[model samples]
Target: MRHTWLICGLAICLSWGTSVRAEVTITPDVVYGHKSGLAMTMDVFTPTENVNGAGVLFMVSGGWYSRWQPPEQMQDRFKPLTDKGFTVFAVRHGSSPKFSIPEAVSDVRRSVRFIRKNSDRFQIDPQRLGVYGYSAGGHLSLMLGTASDDGDPAAKDPVDRVSNRVAAVVAFVAPTDLRIMVKDAPDRLDAYARFPALDLDLKAAEADSPLVHVTPDDPPTLLIAGDKDDLVPIEHSRNIQAAFEQADVTSRLIEVAGAGHGFRGEDARRSTASMVEWFQSQLAP
Candidate 1:
C-alpha cells in the first residue's frame, strides 16, 4: 500500500513580513498519551510565519500499522498544511498485530483529548481541529469524527476530561463499515485480510465502525473514494454520506472515475486540494 505522501505537488504559500516564505519547523515525538507503557506520539508541524493557529491532525497509519519516520520526512509529507499556516500533528497510534482496532481507536481518542487539553501550548484553537488520512489512517479519522464525546467529568485522566471531537474530516478511501469488512473477511485474499487489524468479529467490528455512530453533531466530513476501488468500495463512502445526510450533517463524497484505492498524479493533487478547501471552509471563524 502506498503511504499517503504523494502530495508534495500541493503548493501552499505562507505570508511573511514584507515577503512570503514556506519554511516549517517540526517538533518531533511530542507524546500525547501512553498506552500499556508505550508512548502514543505525534510530530507537530508549525509554519515559520503566518501561523493560522488552527491545528490539523494527519493520521499516520497503514493497515493499522503506525511507525515513526524521521522528522525531515514529515516536513515534506505535511508541508502543504504547514505552509498554509495550519499546525499539523502527525498522530501515531498503537499498531495492530500487537494491539486490536479497538485499542487503536482508544489511542487516537486519547491523543485528540490530550492535544485539545494542551491546545494553548501549541497555540491552536481547540475548536478548530481537523483530521485527515488514507486507508487505515482514514478509517481512524472517521472513528474520531463520528464517535466523539464531551469530556468525562468524572474521569481520572485529565485528557479523558477533554472532548475528542473534531471540526472537520477528510478521509481518503477509508473503510467505513468494519462490519461489512468482517463479513467479507472470510473470502478476502488481499493483504488486508492477512493483517491482524481486520481480525475483529461481528460485535467488535460494529463497535469500532464509524458509520455506526454518526450523528448530526459529528464533524463535517469530506470523503474521497475511487470508483474502481474494490478493496474498500466507493459504496463505503456513499453509505456514510447517506447517513450523514439523514442526520442533517454536512458531508460530501467524491468518486474518482478511473481511480482505485490509492489516487495518483492529478487525482492525488485534486483530492488534496479538495481536502484543504474543506478544512478552510469548515474551520473558518
Candidate 2:
C-alpha cells in the first residue's frame, strides 16, 4: 500500500577504537505497518563504512512475543552482520495476549514489503534481502521464506506492489510443524491461549504451518536447532529438512551437540558465526 514512513535523521556511532573501527548509522522507530491504530516499527542499522549493498531482516521474537530493542542494546547480536558489511533491520511485531500469531505474521510480511518498496532509500538491493530469527522468530522467518508472494501490480498501494520474498533464511530452534508440535506436547497449545476466539480448525493449522508450504522456489534455508532442546523437539527440524528434500529445495539442518533450546557460551558464538557466514554467502552482491 502507499503507506507513510516516518524516518528520522541518521544517528552515527563508532564501534571499537580508531585503529579498526566501523561507522554504523541507526534509524529507530520507522513505521512499517499499523494494526488497531498502533504502528509497527523497526530499527534499521546501516554500516556507513564498507557498505555491502544487501540487507538482512531480523525478527526479535521469543515465545511468539516481540519487543523493540534499541540499536545500542542489540549491538552484540547485530555486530557480526554489520562487521561483514550487511545492513540489518530489526523488526518488531505485535505481541501475544493482545495479538494472535496470524496477526504477527502479517505485520512481519508488511515490514518486508515496506523494506523492498523503499530499498533505494536504504541503498541496498531489494532482491538480496535475507531473514534471520530465533525460536518463535525463527518460525516466522521460515513462514516468510516458504509463503512469500509477489505484490499485485493492480494494487493502488505501491508497497503492496512489492514482493515479500527473500534470497536466504536462517532460523534457529523453530517449530516448522505446528500439528506435530501440538501432538507431541498438548500442553504446548497453551501458547495459543491468546487466540481463544478462533475455531479449532485443522485446515487452518495446516495452512498456517510452514512445513506444508515448502517448494522448489522457496529461498535457501538453514535450520539450526539444539539436540537437547525439550521445548521445541529436534524432530521439528528433521521433519522440515525432509520436507525440503521432498520439494527439491536447498536446505540444511544443524544440530548443536549438548545444546538446548537456548545456545550459550561457545555454542552461541558458533551459531552467530554460522548465520553470518550463511547470509554473506547467500546474500552477497
Candidate 3:
C-alpha cells in the first residue's frame, strides 16, 4: 500500500494504485545545464502511445534539497500523466547546503529554457508545457509559474533565448512567501537552523518568494493543499490563491479536508485527478 510520493515534501509513504498502464520511452539524466562544473539533470518520459505533444515538469525537490531515482522505477508514479499523453520531465536541481534557494530557482529556470529550446526534438509544443510538484517542489513550481522570463533574444546562449514561461502549474502545499515563514511561526523553527535555504534575510527571501511576483500574465494555476497541513501550512496556499484572484489570473484552490502535506486514499485520488483535469483544460490547443 506504500507508493513513492515524489515531490518537495520528501518521500512520503502513501496509498495509490501502482500498476503501470502506460508505456513510455524512459530517458534518464539528460543534462539541462551545468553549475560549478556539475551537470544539472532531468529525466524525460515520452509516451509510446497517445502522444499529446504536451510536457509536464515534476520538480524533484524537497526542502530545497533535490534527489533523484531512476526513471524506469517511477513508471507507475508517472502513469497518471503519461496515460493522459503528457511527456513528463523529472527535473532535479542543485540541493540545499550545497546550493541555496536562489540558485535552485535559477537552475530550474534554465531547465525550462532548455526544454523549450529542444521542444521540437521532444515533440511537444514549446507553449504547451506545464509544471507540477509538492511542498518545496511546489514552491519551485509556483516560482516558475509566477516569476517567468521572456528570454533575452540577444543572449549568447540559444537556449537562454527561449521563453521560460509555462502554460499551467499544479503547486501542492507550497510555501508561497518565504519572507514570513520564519517570523509567523508559533515558535522557533528547527528547519531554519538545519536548512540553510530556509534561513534568509528579508531581502533575499522576498526576491525568492513567489507571492512577491504574481502578475496578470501568470499562467493559470491550480493549487491543491490539505487544510490540516502543519509543515508548510494551508495559509501559504490560501494567501497565494487569494493573490491570484485579486490579480484576475485564472486559478483554483482545492483544499483536501483532513489531509496533510501528503495525501492518501481518496484524498490522493482526488488530488491526482484535479491535477490531470487542470492540465487537460489548460494545456490543450
User: How would you encode candidate 2's per-residue C-alpha lDDT over 1-285 as one tens digit per residue?
Assistant: 100101101122233211223467777777887779888888888887888999999987776677655567776668899988898999988876477667778888889999998898888999999998987788889999999899888998788888999899999988787664433335564534433412235555566689989999999999999998766779889998999989988888999997777777898899999999899889878
TM-score of each model, paired residue for residue: 0.90, 0.87, 0.90
Model 2 earns a TM-score of 0.87
List the lowest-lDDT window of 10 residues for candidate 2. 1-10
lDDT of 3 by residue, 16-42 (tens): 212233477777778888889888888
Candidate 2 global CA lDDT score: 0.78
Q: Can you list the residue pairs that collide in candidate 1?
A: none
Clash pairs of candidate 2?
Answer: 1-160
Runs in model 1 with CA error above 4 Å? 1-22, 183-191
CA deviation > 4 Å runs, candidate 2:
1-22, 181-201
Compared with the true structure, all predictions reach lDDT values of 0.82, 0.78, 0.84
How many residue pairs clash in model 2?
1
Task: Summing lDDT over every window of 10 consecutive residues in candidate 3, give the lowest-scoring window.
Answer: 9-18
Quote the positional error of residue 62 for candidate 3 in Å.
0.6
Ordered from best to worst lDDT, the candidate numbers read: 3, 1, 2
